[model samples]
Target: MAGPGQRGVGEPPRLLKIVMAGESCVGKTSIVRSYTDPHGAPTSSSYLTTIGIDFKVKPVMFDDIRVKLQIWDTAGQERFHTLSTSYFRGAQGFVLVYDITNLDSFQGITSWMKDIHEKAGDEVDIILLGNKCDKESERVVPKQKGEKLAWEHGIPFFETSAKDNVNIEDAFSVLTKEILEKKSCVLYDFDVVALNESKKRTCCAF
Candidate 1:
């Protein structure tokens, strides 16, 4: 029996695993915390360093689909690199964060993307986010360059201010939509059938 707003049996809810990665102090944790708890007061400062990885689950309704996003926030410093790769194994989506006010952080995006591709592979969906967009005076990375990079990588780019709540929801929503649309091709039983057929063809050719 279906609950009031639930889908019927055998139909799995659309679930996505997303990871946030960037250089140290690039505002990855702030973005995640803001999105998860929009009404909560802003923190004075980031208190704890993300040791290895942290997880949070948030359910959102996109059109008719119910999406449960499993968000993984990883440590961004070089020391945490080894610990971080393990969390990227099964990621379906990624949010590559960079601080607009920090040139070094923005430049380091290429390295983050490389790590993501090396671990999660090229097929995983990714969105490039420019954090701290509200700090116009300190903005170092031009928005156009971010867009260009995102285009080159075949991913969407968003300029967000987690502190001011600017484009915060929009960025996340776009990611969810992209994941549901692109990743949907392999999420269910039909993909299993396709895989079996592919395997059969390979075996028969041997």
Candidate 2:
């Protein structure tokens, strides 16, 4: 029996795992917090760094289907690389973050990209995010630079300010859509193969 507004028996929400990775102080944690808890709290000046990896699960509805996103917030420090990198194996998508106010953080993206390719493989979906976009006076990495990087890498890009709640939902939504599309394509291919096999058996019967 199906409860009101709930999926019936055997119809469970799809599970998606996503990870956030970038250099230290790039606001990856803030993005996760903002998306998961839109009205939780204001951004704090003295925020503690994540030690190893923290995660949160959020359920969202898309096209009448419920999807549960398991988001892992990874530590950006080099000491935690071994631990964080291990979480990338089963990720369906990733949010690669960079601080707009810090040129070094933006430059460090090369190493992060390398890690992604090495751990998550090249086929995984990724979205580039320029955090702290509200700090215009402190901006060092221009929007054009982020856009160019995304274009070169063939990924979508967004300028987001987690403190101000800018484009946080959009970024996650884009990645979720990509994951669902990829999953749908895989299922479609399997169905086509099964149909072809069925046709072969039917012809033999005749």
Candidate 3:
């Protein structure tokens, strides 16, 4: 039976795993909380430390299709490197965060990038996020520096404030769209998702 909305209202959404990685206190957890907050409540200013790892399940709708995002929040502590790095497998995308107010956190992104590439597959998409943009007075890492790093690695970049919910949804939406627009690729809970010329024509004809 075909439902009214989209193509398959009853069909299970395609699952996509995403991970947030960065140095400690870079606001990884806060970002997830803001995105998945059901009540639209304000994000707490208090620092929330993830001990080992945490997961949040969010189903985001793209027009008519719903995609479930299993977002893994990794502990930034060096002690958890062995545990956190293990969870990077099978993830389709990564949101690498860096605190704009902390230069050291910015510098630590190199190692995180290496770990993500080594632990996760090389083909996975990644977006660089500079968090805490609301704290302009304490800005240590310039936006140009962040832009340069992203350019060097060939990834999209966004300056976000989780507390204020600035650019959080935009970044995730862009990454999701990129992941979905790939042709003849396999993702979780689905088989052979293709957005090629044939698929596009079929969709347009509908």
Candidate 4:
């Protein structure tokens, strides 16, 4: 893991935008803070609702390639739900977070996912995150419930505790790898076409 603001000097790091979405007070902002905070500060479990939107960046290195993750945290209120659609534009990935103790929040994931695909298109990558997993005593949604929902939507699911710093890094790492693989595939296709064009030009010159 690269430290915050740490990157190579040669080429500009490729920026990938990811949006955090779910019902209000599902620890979306906490998750973002936990991931981007370099000093490993403890995130508070208290519910703090996001008003509108805020974003932060974390510089990361994967296989010697520097990448910057531009993570956007959005308000999850019903009024702001429609507002999230606007920010969905150009987002490469979405982390749908729900509190494990709140079954209603978990139920809200489907609605959020619909808005995501409606605004960001079907090709955008999504991951289902069951937050506050450390609260086992108060858990309303079971582990298999989250897994079943994720499977139904064909997206990866993770149980994370932002306050406890559990699975936060692992979940983000998996999402980053998925996005990078898609980007690498696109670049590879472009290179193949460019190489073929060069061959045609060379044959014509001869």
Candidate 5:
């Protein structure tokens, strides 16, 4: 991962805007910090809730491409919901985080997903993240339940611990790959049309 203000030369890296959404105190901010600055020390578990939104940008290499992710960590409180939901606009993907230790947090994914789609559109890519896996004893949301929810909705899923740094990169990587794939499809269609146009012009010239 490239540090802040650091980027590779050549073509400009594609910017991918992503949002972290879930119930309050689900470690959304921690996940953003971890993924953007993996070398930094892990965030303490007792951090206060986000007020409105936190933002970060990190450059990552995937295959031959470098993508700069614009991550928005939105507040999960009900009062901030309106303000947070506005940030969902133009986001290419979302990380719906929930704490495994809190059953209410896990159950809140349904409503979060609903709001995300309402603002960002249904085609936006999403991943179910069960956070705080390090506290195994406190885990109330079983892995199966999370997996089932993911499967039922056909979205990718992973268990992550912001403190332990578990599956955090995998979750982001999966979402980025989906974004890149969609971009590739659109570019390929343009190329096909361009090729057809060239063929028609050459035939007319002959």
Candidate 6:
């Protein structure tokens, strides 16, 4: 593991590979754009569509630790299911998104979570994000229900508004921090053979 201030001149300190999975038009892209370009003006619409999978890298500082987030935005179309599974390889964390105004999107969370756990393992870190929180009048899924679902799955949940920039940063920040903490703990466990070999080598030199 690379510590803070130890990164090479041009290289990043840590790489966090995260994947955003949800139904189409659930504001996954908007959330990514808002975090990556917070100051940019909102556009009326954008026709950009993720073919198999699209990636973006953004550097963020969490409690003095610099982290480079490798975000993968996946296609939600049913026809692309075969292609999307391939992108799940080596994903350390996940952001399961759902539109607040769409009930179907919320219902699909179960299947999506199962797919992620199957591909990345049950130990993989995950965060649930309810997008379009600003649209309260049109919300079909209640906040308490979403929170309950997240609790049942043992994952953190947040209501985020990409349009208003509400809790968007907090959601990602917490998930990233959790990922780093888990990674650090795993790195502390040393192999018995490696430790014994080093001790023997030191004794011979002396």
Go through the candidates in order and give the clash count of each: 0, 0, 0, 0, 0, 0
Distance (Å) between predicted and true CA of 113, model 6? 0.2
- CA lDDT of each candidate? 0.82, 0.86, 0.86, 0.84, 0.85, 0.81
> What is the per-residue lDDT of model 6 for residues 7-32, given as tens digits with 9 covering 90 to 100?
33343346788898988878777788
Q: Give the lDDT of residue 178 in candidate 5.
A: 84
Of the candidates numbered 3 and 5, which has the greater TM-score value?
A: 3
Better of 2 and 4 by TM-score: 2
Report residue 111 deviation for candidate 5 (angstroms): 0.6
In candidate 6, what residue range of length 10 has the lowest lDDT sum?
184-193
Q: How well does candidate 2 match the true structure in TM-score terms? A: 0.84
Higher TM-score: candidate 2 or 3?
Answer: 3
Worst 10 residues of 1 by lDDT: 1-10
Clashes of 6: 0
Could you give candidate 3's per-residue lDDT for residues 1-206 as a string of tens digits? 12323566566677788999999889999999988992574664775789999999998787566788889999998999889989998888999999999999999999999999999868888999999999999999999999999999999999999988899999999888767665234354535354366688898999
Candidate of highest TM-score: 3
Listed in order, each prediction's TM-score against the native is: 0.82, 0.84, 0.84, 0.82, 0.83, 0.81
lDDT of 4 at 187: 31
lDDT of 5 by residue, 5-81 (tens): 24344545677888999999989988887787768845647567898988998788776576778899999999999
TM-score of 1: 0.82
Q: Tens digits of per-residue lDDT for model 1 on 65-101?
A: 6667889999999989989877998888899999998
Error in Å for residue 23 of model 2: 0.6
Model 4 C-alpha lDDT per residue in residues 68-152, reported as the tens digit of each score: 8889999988898778779998888999999999989998888898899889999888999999988999999999999999999
